[model samples]
Target: MKKLTAFIMLIALTGCSKLSMDNYQLLKTGMSYDEVTAIIGKPDSCEEALGTRSCVWGDEQKQIKAAFLAEKAMLFSHQGLK
Candidate 1:
């Protein structure tokens, strides 16, 4: 009933997240964090340490991840994006 309908809607909405193969491809090395966020929106979570940062968008099963050094993008990868 209503609960089931809500559940399905939740899944549908999550599926429409900004994290996708197309957006992930827009990433490039040397892009600043602000530039990266402008493309994929803010990350779901991020961690910083030792003058570097790691950020992730979306969830565990479907997500885009980036590693930054000197405040610029150094590497980017994704999981379960389709």
Candidate 2:
């Protein structure tokens, strides 16, 4: 039964179509990090450790790759200077 359910879910996912900012006018590329952050507020999830910042948004990486999707940008500091 679990296998059957999983198979069904896979089929549904393959058949369905998803949309993102590509279909909307609100987001675009080359915008400043601050501008993107102001519009999106915050990322769904983020990692800020060891002078590295990573953010994840949307179910697929491709979606986040779209314009102005990332809401957070980490400024790395080495020896207390960015």
Candidate 3:
């Protein structure tokens, strides 16, 4: 009942946060991290090394990855994460 309804709502909201191709197409090299996040929602995972950062959005079936250097996007890609 209430718990099941709440769970469904949570899943719906989570699905809405996933990245879309329209937003992904808007990404460009040299865009800032904030700009990229604005297009796609917050990343599901992120990692950084040696002043470079990589962020990913979406689930295992589909995902988008953006790499940043100096706080600006240097590379981007999207595909099935599986």
Q: TM-score for each prediction?
A: 0.78, 0.33, 0.73
Task: Please list the C-alpha lDDT of all candidates, in the order they appear.
Answer: 0.93, 0.44, 0.86
Local lDDT at 30 for model 2? 53
Runs in model 3 with CA error above 4 Å? Answer: 1-18, 80-82
- Name model 1 segments beyond 4 Å from true: 1-16
Ranking by lDDT: 1, 3, 2
Clashing pairs in 3: none
For residue 54, give model 2's deviation from the true position in Å: 0.7
Candidate that would win on TM-score: 1
lDDT of 3: 0.86
Better of 1 and 3 by TM-score: 1
Pairwise lDDT winner, candidates 1 and 3: 1
Candidate 3 residue lDDT tens string, 1-82: 9999999999997777446676677899999999988888789999999999999888667999999999999999998632
In model 2, which regions exceed 4 Å deviation? 1-19, 22-33, 65-82
Please give the TM-score that candidate 3 achieves against the real structure: 0.73
